[model samples]
Target: MRAATKENNVRTCLACGAKSDKGALLRFAAAGTIIVPDWRGTLGGRAVYSCLTTDCVARFYTLKRFPEKFFKGTPAFAISQGEIHGWIKTQAEASLAHFLGLARKSGVLTLGQNTLADILENGGTAPTAVLLAADLADRTLREITGIVPVGTPVLRWGTKETIGASIGMRPVGVVALGRSPITDRIVHYCAIVNHFSQEH
Candidate 1:
């Protein structure tokens, strides 16, 4: 049997603006109090796809687009973004943990202050996203912001131990754009990070 490639299976996440192969993303439906994928895509309803990032899940919730899209014709109860985020977090953390295991083998993964600072100074670029443990949040948030160069949209995930453990990662800081309270924030963050990172 032959394998499918990106060209033939491209899918985009409307929520977080991430693109991937169709098989690489998960689809979710808005029903009752949450946005959830049928996994089989068998459950009938309007659908949205989310990439592996918990941030993407949070984006869907904050935007409040799931129930509106999924239950448009149904008589279901209104769903909250918070509920959707919670569900996504459950999945994302697990995905992140698997990803981390792979990263560990490649020697590209970093932890602690010196490693993170180098990431900040060098402009973080790794095949996998930066994952910090939750306990480091207060210190990492400030350091990340300092090194991240202003105007880079930082997506934050507030933590609980479950989400943290699932990813084998804790909440620290993210310096990327997926969703936004305001589009301009992402735009500005991107511009500033790029501009300053180049200058330094």
Candidate 2:
């Protein structure tokens, strides 16, 4: 499959009809009677896209576009907005977990604080981004942030235990996602999760 980041690829949001880079939009695939978030963009079926903003997500359901646009020819069914919100949250979390696991297996992710700090300090081949545990200590967080290269994205995601488990390690305070094919997807899903968190 082609990478979603191909420059020529663009998607139109079903909710607002805004055109955006395919990578900037969230994908949803028809699943029987319900529509589900397809953050990986791998699900096979009719797909709809939406921008990353919370307004776009809210508009998607507020405008009631899913059934008409994605489930044509089937009788319309009602689903609570709260239910859809929950599904999107679940999908975002699962997508994040999956991507982190893949990065670990592909050997593109570095776990532990010192290893990441060394990579940043050495400046040989720095990671594209840093993932810190949400509960990281203030002193440690400050130290890591001080060493991270400017313009590199730093994300506070998941608990220490959650991040550690994704990489088959014990609880870790931070991880560095190196330059790799999956890095873009990792960044995208992290944004989605952040958006969801801010919304609800």
Candidate 3:
């Protein structure tokens, strides 16, 4: 459809002090005296937020004050910038791959260069979003961009080899995801990965 919009859960970034959607921010839940990461926001506890920008994430870890204001309580967060970044990055990637596997089982994933080319040239199931491998050929990218549905989010993700491995196939240059909870979560993890690195 269009760009993903914000909902009611707006949080201020602990690092940048900017207001943003919760899904776009990283959440850390309190556990005893440590601020444990709650990546998917699936935990129930006091929490704080930091937007997923490289600068914001860096600033967040360097905070001298624990920002009890944001968390609504004090927890001597036993975490480092490297830990947060690495943990979330690893989790986001593994989660994306896991969801891709689920998509395969659920029958909502489409891949293969020739198959995608044929589908784009002709007609078939409409994709909610399209993912092109990072090392995808420029010629194929040009062809696909010219044919991709307008307003559909197009992202460049893992290398052809990595992307293919995730879905149990040979090297794949492109993949189309259909609308479903699986796709939605894929998009969310994609956001986490992209925004976290910023340059990704």
List lDDT for all candidates, in order: 0.47, 0.79, 0.79
Instruction: List ranges where model 2 is wrong by over 4 Å.
Output: 1-9, 21-23, 29-45, 64-79
How many clashes does the backbone of model 2 have? 0
Off by over 4 Å in 1: 1-7, 10-25, 28-85, 118-129, 132-140, 149-200
- Candidates, ranked, TM-score: 2, 3, 1
Tens digits of per-residue lDDT, candidate 1, 20-74, equal: 8654466766666555564445667676676645556456545633345554543
Candidate 1: residue 101 Cα off by (Å): 2.8
lDDT of 2 by residue, 29-147 (tens): 88787666776788997888888777787788665345565676533324456665666667778878888989989998888889887766677687799999999999999988888
- What range of 10 consecutive residues in model 1 has the weakest lDDT sum? 175-184
At residue 17, candidate 3 shows an lDDT of 86
Better of 1 and 2 by lDDT: 2
Candidate 1 Cα deviation (angstroms), residue 136: 3.3
Better of 1 and 3 by lDDT: 3
Tens digits of per-residue lDDT for model 3, 112-142: 6577667767877668988888898899898
Model 1 pairs in collision: 133-170, 134-170, 134-171, 151-189, 151-190, 152-189
Best candidate, TM-score? 2
